[model samples]
Target: MELTSGIRDFALTPDELSGFHARGYYGPFKVYEVDEMRRAWRGERLRLMDREYAVYRSEAAESGNTNIANYDRHLDSAYLADHITQRRITDRVTSVLGPDVLCWRTEFFPKYPGDEGTDWHQADTFANASGTPQILWPDGAEEFGGTITVWTAFTEANEETGCLQFIPGTHQSMFYDETKRMHYDPSSINRKEKDGVRRGFFGYDYRQLQKDPDWTPDESQAVSMVMRPGEAVMFWSTLMHASLPHAGNVPEARMGFAARYVPTSVRVYPDTEEIEEYGGRVSLERHGSVLVSGEEKYSHNRLVDRTTRGHRFVSN
Candidate 1:
């Protein structure tokens, strides 16, 4: 079903487009009304607990703490399937990624009260955790290689609730090498501090992938993104970004749904059958990229139109 009555376009203006290129990120723009988002989330949250159609079906896929469990709920849930193709998101995403785009992956980022902030990091091949390039761009695509991430705030995201932070213009160069290995220790979560801020990268230390072990992120240059429910931000995955620790001042958890997009020409999870991360491993048996915009002319990656539940995905 269509999200609304008429055609809605949320494409970025020329100035906004240029600003994103300059800063490596764009807007906490409106995607849904506050009350609408809250209501939708209330039902969707319960529905998500029944993940019978989810792509990953390993033992760890049922664990609340493992990141693998949160991967690609869009592939199963009707609400999320519509969200990825929502014009509010896809219009702006295509403004940056061009006409033909594929939503390769999506993941949920939740921070409960007293939860540690995410470590400052950037993803190029997204191999920081798994030690394998998840997405491989074409040989001549060196000018831009990382995926465009559209992170939607499902709940209040503020300083107290661990909102995201970004260092402007840092997407052009990667300070961390995805080829380097990172050790995963779930116990290390919320147990360490970087520059006096409580932080960790899920179960691994993102610093382990840093090209310069001696170099540290300059916190002074970072800016926090405070957003209300239903707002969304788009940025290059290679941008230097992280979140603050939830201070426990508020009872509500900060929930972020991140949908990752790349041009159809790029190979999604090249030659990978399974992903091992966050202390768990899962098969990619049912994984396929959703073409969110335009026609797919490439056959290098798998593509799916309808979700596992027979709900057709909205494509523009």
Candidate 2:
């Protein structure tokens, strides 16, 4: 859809498109009303507890489960299945990544009260903690590569509840090397502090992946992203981003659902049958990317027409 074609109501404006390219991030636009989100989440949260159709079936998939288990709930839940293809998200995403796009991955990022903030970092090949590239871009776009991540605030995401932070325009160049290895120790959760801020990358320290051992992110340049219950933000996965620690004065937690997208040309996961991360390992037996929009001309990875629990994916 060309910028002037008036293709979709939500199609980004020329200025917004250019701004996204310049900043590597987009708005916290409304995807659902606040009252509606509250009601939907109340029921959906309970429904998610029973994961009979969740893609990752390992015993590791638990409520507080961190890594692989937290990955791809959209592949099972009817609400999430329809959520991914919602035009409110897809229209803007398609404007950035042509019409032929694939929803390769989705995950839950939750920060309960007293939880540590995420360390400042960027992901290129997304191999920082996994020891293998999760998403591989085509050779042509190799130098400047990363997936488009649309993170929706499922619940209130504020500074006190651990809102997101980004160093604008830091997506083009990675500050951390993904090829570097970071050891995972389950005991490390909420036990470490970096530069005075309580933070941990799941079971591993994200600082271990930094390209410079002595260098630290200039925190003075950071900007916090406070979003409402139903708002969403689109950003490049490679952006220098992190989150504030949940200060813990309240009972409610911050829940952000991230949906990752890439052009069909990209390979989802090459030569990897299982993922080992966050102190657990899970097989990719039921893993498949959903084509949320346009045609899939490339057969580089597996594609599923609908969700496993019989939730039909909304294809645009």
Candidate 3:
């Protein structure tokens, strides 16, 4: 499949949709030319430093774990705000999630040279890290409750640079239970291993919450998502996925921007006001999920029409 100008011509064909449901993931589809993505990041990185309108509290934004600190820029940055609504990303996301969708979260996954690979895991309520049910689907939709994640590579992602890897068709059943508790120790960041691989879940070991301590994810079916800058992959948040350790000798880091989408029927951050996790805490006073497509008929969550910079969030 060839790349098209986003929004103008980028809906998935029937076969593409079928493949996505069967495999639980789809694409290293092109969103921007390698050079185009590289150029955009060069300038945007500087503007991102000013996060005055960022939704998270100062403590959360300054957490020792960079992933937590880099959460949800789409709520503040114009570039990211526009990004979550892109046709190439949103159209496909809506296809899986249905027309009325809300982008409840965005995160930056950055892996520096020699950093530990992400532990193989999946998320349902996203309570794995925070120990709080962040999203709740209605009873009828409970069977498929996880969010749809569109992860875009903002930099080169390869085996050596800690690219993503996935075990196909594993979205149907979960190996780990989010309700189980996992101790968060910031010192454990780069100092853990599972099944012999040097990996850790930011500050927690994912295996702590495994449904069966004796059961481990089979790594034999893993496929590396080596992508050029600007390419993206869409997957169920419950899919068995992990990443390689950044072993490259280069100083450049791998950056994957992930925007999470869910249907309007789902309640985001249900009965939660503060996110306490990863050895830190953040208040959600300023947090608001953006409507990326269709319309919102529910009043369960706060909605934002513009970014902190006064940039409008255009809904498709």
Q: Pick the candidate with the highest TM-score.
A: 1
Tell me how candidate 3 scores on lDDT: 0.84
Global fold similarity of model 1 (TM-score) = 0.95
| Tens digits of lDDT, candidate 3, 1-316 | 0112234357778999999999999998998899989999999989988766666756656644445668878877888888888888988887788778888988889899989999999999999987789999999775797899999999999998999999999999989889889987779888877778778888888889989999978799999999999999999999999998888688999999999999888999999987777766778777778877777887787777745454343332
Each prediction's TM-score against the native? Answer: 0.95, 0.94, 0.93
Q: After superposition, how far is residue 165 of candidate 3 from its true place, in Å?
A: 0.6
- 67 Cα displacement, candidate 3 (Å): 3.3
The residue-level lDDT of candidate 2 at 114 comes to: 96
lDDT of 2 by residue, 37-145 (tens): 9899999989988878887878776554657777988888889889998889989998998888888889989899999988787877777777899888888876658
* lDDT (0 to 1) per candidate: 0.88, 0.84, 0.84
Which clashing pairs does model 3 show?
A: none
The whole-model C-alpha lDDT of candidate 2 against the native structure comes to: 0.84
Error of 1 at 122 (Å): 0.2
lDDT of candidate 1 over 250-279, digit per residue (tens) = 888899999999988898899999998888
